[model samples]
Target: MTKYQLFKKLPLFAYVNKIHVRYNPGGPNTETCRKLMLMLLDPKTFTKHPYLTFTYELLSFNERPEVFLTLVPQVPFRFHADTCTLDDIHRAIDADQYKAHCDYLKRRSIESKYVQEE
Candidate 1:
């Protein structure tokens, strides 16, 4: 599948407050990280999560690449960009996002029921 197809509907992003990526433009192992940055910066991704904040840095050639995600609840997840593929990153984020979507649905249901009873 295409990278866009893989990341176009990440529900976890709805629950993400911010994302930060660090990579060295000249680093040999950072190609995937750079590609990820491009994907995250796509207009489709912005349309899907308009409120999401994204920031990135170009590190020195010797520095390691990394991606950081901050959830709405203030939890942080860190990934080593140099060691993983785009698919690996997608799978991890997808799993977390799916769970977050499920939790949001459950919370909405409970809130609605509570309101009805009151």
Candidate 2:
């Protein structure tokens, strides 16, 4: 897919706490990583995820490009950008966010049940 195709709206990052990206600007294969970072920095993305923190590093030309996501429960997920498409990264984050939401709802239900019992 073309790089512009990856600029579409991103899924809600409700469960994500922090995003860290490492990419080499001069590297020919780091286009995906650069595009991903741009998407994260978009105004619409910021509006959708107000509480998220974003940090990025420009690596040397010899280094690999990677993205790291820190979930609400302090879970760390890593993705290699050079070998994956933007869609792949989005799908993985979407799946993890869904799981986190489900886990949150489950915990809340259990807590409410105990409170009702008390």
Candidate 2 wrongly placed segments (more than 4 Å): 1-12, 105-118
In model 2, pairs of residues that clash are none
The CA lDDT at 38 in model 2 is 77
Per-model TM-score, in order, reads 0.74, 0.72
Give lDDT tens digits, candidate 2, residues 1-118. Answer: 6566643443646788998889988787888878877788789987887889999998888888998888887878888889887778767777667777777788678555534563
RMSD of each: 5.2, 6.9
* Candidate maximizing lDDT: 2
Q: What are the per-residue Cα lDDT tens digits for candidate 1 across 1-118?
A: 6555553666545678788899988788888888878878789988888878989998987888998987765778898899987777667777667667777777679555434663
Candidate 1, RMSD to the unseen true structure = 5.2
**Residue 35 displacement in candidate 2 (angstroms):** 1.5
Q: lDDT of all the models against the reference?
A: 0.78, 0.79
Which residue pairs show collisions in model 1? 12-97
